[model samples]
Target chain A: MATTTVRLPRVLEPAVGAVREVTVSGATVQEALADLCAQHPTLTVRLFDEAGELRRHVLCIHNAQATRLTQPEPLADGDELAILPAVSGGSGDGRFEHRR
Target chain B: MTTLAVGTDKGAWLLHSDDQRSWAVDGPLFPGWGVTAFGRAADGTYLAATGSGWFGPGVHRSPDLHAWDQVAAGPAFGDSGPRLEQIWTFTTSLDGRVFCGVAEAGVFVSDDHGVTWEPLRAFNGHPTRAAWQPGAGGMCAHRVLLDGDRMWVAASAIGVFRSDDAGATFVPRNDGVEGAVPDGEPGIGYCVHAVVADPANADVIWRQDHKGVYRTDDGGDSWERIERGLPAGFGFPIARDDASGALFVVPLAADENRVPVDGRFAAWRSLDGGDSWSVAGKGWPDEPTYTSVLRGAIATDGDGGVYLGSTGGELWATADAGDTWQRLPGRYPRIATVALV
Candidate 1:
């Protein structure tokens, strides 16, 4: 049984907002994510899909580089994981502050 | 269950489900980018536009609605004239063509499924530079609707511009639309947000401007204020049912941009073509809910069903076009944008 740790960005830490870590064992990263998501149902919406497939826009980074090739795969022993959000916009708002 | 997408200033998410009682969600989306916009096409392809303040600009594309590919990454748009900088607003045409409305560079469009892009030559060269003043956030084309031969574009202070032949050209048309400051300053509107074009009617349009709700019957040629039953006509988003032209908007507090009195954070729908409205904030929080629904999000399904996710991390839905509202259980993901795609 291999175990891994996951870190979320500060902006995203509040999404789950509560108990941030769970221990899961899987041979591949997919199995590991499945285990993590299964342990924390509240983190479900922030993790997987209704069909059990990984949501495309969301990224799960194993170690430092992006996990583009190894999604839904098993995780190795002590591999660190990080979840990332998708930013969408163009240049314009930098000059003027958001006036609320 | 509706396959949902919620993008917040914090990040973006992809939600999926078939069992109405239960839904599956995934990702804070872009951790570094800070997602604000989500666009899903007909074939289930999803595009998330992120705004990485001081970091960089990027977009994520997911072919299967889950498990995305970092397909495009760069400075969102141009820095100054003819240059792209950090993107704040990303929109998609009905045909799934991607368009990014930048701050200084005017606008850019991607005909290659968001993988590549180009500039909007016309609006960028509108010849109305001096007259087209910048808004608080410099400016962006807040909302965009593509017509057969022209594109209807709305911004903060540049008023409105129309482009013919796929953003190849632009013309300004600002008549009947009015504005005022958030502090009731004399004549300060033009900070418009969401722009909706009736998929069925080319000329009819709806927008949630800075000060009021507006409708244009002659495309962007002219606009009329519609404020019959709204608590406050101004909001960040105005949603239209792609199938019915049913207009939906969240009312903000009149004096301040908070929840309107009576806990009516529910969405209002105008079936009589934007003339009158009714309350739909039943299950929505009643007080102190300052969830500023950002423009370009807050959408409805084909069933006249509306769904809104807020920066407040609350996901609320109405199965029957504001007849009633319900608060669904989900992450308080600071919904910067919402789509029932």
Candidate 2:
């Protein structure tokens, strides 16, 4: 098993005790995310849908490169995995604040 | 203490008052998420429904309204089923079963407070499932009302549904209501916005429809227009004060222009069980204030207290069941739902 770091955006920080980065061990991206969810069970719903697939609006990045969770790729120790939402913006009616 | 749990497009807030005269605000909890609905379990556990564009929908539980913990297993659909968009409303049954009304239009149930959930497939797969269409606000099951085995589920554009056998089956209850979509199936296209039933008699229910205001004494088998003093037939919310049996509605001009009639904002009240209506109370702004109240934005504390939040992010309260009003302090994101905790 490989130990890697997982990063999340601010919107998801609340589920992980307001922490942006977490460490887990897995051989592939899917396993790593599964491990992350096992530690913070609440993140399961936020990161994946009922079908056990990563939510379509969410993207997975590995070492600064876009990656798909479905296609399992071997992870190396100290590797970094980042989860981010798709870029979106529109006229604000004071309802939603755009965050980067 | 009187605390109003205010859910908004961005977060949730709790307004506390010792005597209902002076208020203190504490919130914006669950930051960056749309807190859509709030409810209390049979055991007094507070439940809040939250939705995110990227994270999907979830339910949070708390002993007090301030501290919340996300429930790992919330309401959800199957992999091939319609995507669960948002949790619109929650209704706790007499037997402690918690029912959740959700968008993409479906209902879910939780027996152990608000921790775990299972879809009510009978309602989700109603016989008219193929004919259900989205309203302007998206196809959403926004309200769930329960009276023993008789339950009502109201969805936008698709009208209201009644379940007589403990939710095992459901049928459309829009007999006397006008249809929103002309080409839709019989009894399936009525645009019902919100519904309030008589606490003493579940059959006697009031509805605020996209077409008009209506009431039914025969459990939705039929309906009659109740617009005697309403400015217009079109509006979004309908709330009832159980203590005084007073009914409330915020009438808008029409579906085409969803704003207060003539730029005036005031809640209309009917004292004789929705027979006749008039301006609810004093303290309404003298100047023109144009904004719409969402369906789930109005709530009653069951003891003469009524609270409402607006799309304009303002919160208003009535301690004496609409005899007078007071605007609470602080402006936040567009307010979506308010509950008396």
Which one is best on DockQ?
A: 2
lDDT of 1 by residue, B1-341 (tens): 57777776566676777754466777756553456566654455676665443323355577865566544232233333433333555666777777777654367777777666677767766666545555654566656677666787777755667766667666666567775434333222366767777877878888777668898998767788998988887677787766555788877775254554454556777888899987753666656565656565576786767787765678877666666677666775456667765
Off by over 4 Å in 1: A1-100, B41-44, B72-96, B179-189, B242-245, B254-259, B286-288
My TM-score estimates for the predictions, one after another, are 0.70, 0.94
What lDDT would candidate 2 get against the real structure? 0.86
**lDDT tens per residue, model 2, A14-80:** 5666778889899998899999999999999888877888776778899988776768899999788
- Residues A55-96, candidate 1: write the lDDT tens digits: 445567777767754335556887888766534222213312
Which prediction has the highest TM-score against the true structure?
Answer: 2
Candidate 2, residue B38: how far the Cα is off, in Å: 0.9
Scored against the true structure, residue B28 in model 1 reaches a CA lDDT of 57
How would you encode candidate 2's per-residue C-alpha lDDT over B225-335 as one tens digit per residue? Answer: 999988898988999999999899999998888899998898999999888999998988788889878888999988889888888899888989999998989887888
Q: Which structure among the candidates has the greatest lDDT?
A: 2
